[model samples]
Target: MLKNVVAVVLEEVHPFELGVACEIFGLDRSDDGLPVYDFALASARPGPLRTHAGFSVDVPYGAERIAEADLVIAAATGIQDGFPAPLIEALRAAVERGARVLSICSGTFLLGAAGLLDGRRCTTHWRHSERLAARFPLTTVEPDVLYVDEDPVITAAGTAAGIDACLHLVRKVQGPEVARGIARRMVVAPHRDGGQAQFVARPLPAEDGDSLGGLLEWLRHHLDQELTVDQLAARAHMSPRTFARRFQQETGTTPHRWLTGQRVLLAQRLLEGTGEPVDAVAARCGFGNAATLRHHFGRWLGTTPQAYRRAFGGVGQPAGR
Candidate 1:
């Protein structure tokens, strides 16, 4: 249903964020049997637009192109005190006509300026979250999530997270198969829950000899096995309490939370890449049963195992192929 997409470019846009929209929607993947969006780049000012990275891009379209878009994307732009009135009106008009709008990082500000984010839950990069909340007091700003999708609108946290938000829209409209295929071609993860925390409190320092890098890798490979905190503690040669504290300190999440995330990720991959039955995928991912898998998948992905596969299965084939 989301056939046409237009990325609205403004002066001083970040190249990476703009590229995220282009990479996900603008590319022609018809040869892979994926949907090819009628994608275009539109600018309010038109002509050459400067990027934050000391380069400029020639955008050939203008605001008129947005009128036909089923979805509109506002790429991250350099921080400015004001936005163009015509651009803001165009965004408001697009939403008025039932077109979805998405923003990456600071681009959420443009949505705010257009009055689209008013009374809606949204987010931006953590560094700019405070400013965004202060400026748009009517909007509920969630600062620490990868992205926020309040339907009709989606906002991503930072640079890489834009990929997550874009792929999310693809999955929502087209199907999980289309989203996964696009992610595969992009060499990125097919899905990252919008509710996942954006960042850890501290970076894992290289000199910290008490690192859990190897242990984490082992856990990823053995997701089907039962992993208790006590067992993991003994493997790390530390007491249970000590291990728990260390994991929280280093990863900014509890061991259970981290392990559950990994399991869910594995389940997603298996569901998308194979035609295995729900019960088998559940047991393979340590959920033990189809019911248990459904519970966790619903909690994390807002969909059931069967539904996920229905949306994303086929090995390399596109949905309905």
Candidate 2:
């Protein structure tokens, strides 16, 4: 049923996101017995346009192609000084015709500009999550997730998260089996639990040239232990002050915030995948108690731990994923 896909490329469109659309639908994988999707890139004007990375591309298709598309994708691009009226109309027309729509990264801004996400659940790159929320208060914003699949409209985080949204579309259109096969071929994880917090600005590699990557692996393995800033700094052989400053610079967040996010992520997995008591789950995730977990969950996710589990846990079906 999903035969044709139209991707609208705007000025300063990110090449990586455009490439993601091409890789997922533009390639002919019929030899592998995959359904071939008719994929085309369109622009408001059919001529060479500049990209975000300082290059120009010539797209042959124009806005008219979108009218015939079964699915439409908006690739990430730099924001214009103001929204382009014609482009917004084209997007609105496609969505009005019942075409499934998707947006990658800042592309969500375009959807907002077109008034498509007025009452929809959507996400953009976490860095822009606040902006999206401030600009469109009526739209429910879930910044921590990799993508939000709200049936007809799907939105994803930055760059690589676009792949997750595309594969999600494939899984919905085809099946999980087909999606898993493609993921394996792509050498990416079959699935990522939690959300974009799992990939958000991570702490930089240790300056000691020891590669904190291994240290992080160890920390994950020992999350149940009480972790202090001093202990974490010691692991990297730096003074607590220096470590704290560097951690914020590298991860774009403080050590305390990152730790809290990790613990919450762990608690979510436990709550969903296991029958562990909330108290035990909290302890394992460094919350030390169910009340703590519940408090943080309410603060960050706008729900209690029990409610979150019931909504997204075993035998519990979330209204949307």
Worst 10 residues of 2 by lDDT: 193-202
Steric clash pairs (candidate 1): 177-312
- Clash count in backbone of candidate 2: 0
lDDT of 2 by residue, 1-321 (tens): 588998888999999999888988888877777778899888887888889999998888988888889888999998655666777888888888888889999999988888889998999988888999999888998987789877688898998888988887886676555566677767885444324452434445757774546666787777788999999999889999988876765655677776777787688777766777788898999889988888989876668887766655666434223
Task: For each candidate, give its TM-score against the true structure.
Answer: 0.89, 0.64
Q: Rate the local accuracy (lDDT) of all candidates.
A: 0.88, 0.80
The lDDT leader among the candidates is 1
For model 2, state the Cα shift of residue 317 in Å: 22
* lDDT tens digits, residue span 1-321, model 1: 699999988888999999999999988999999998999999986799989998999999988889999999999998778988778888989999999999999999999998888989999999999999999899999998999999899999999989999999998888777887899999998888787778865557557566887888898889899989999999999999999988877776789988888888888888878767778888899889888889999988888877777766765633321
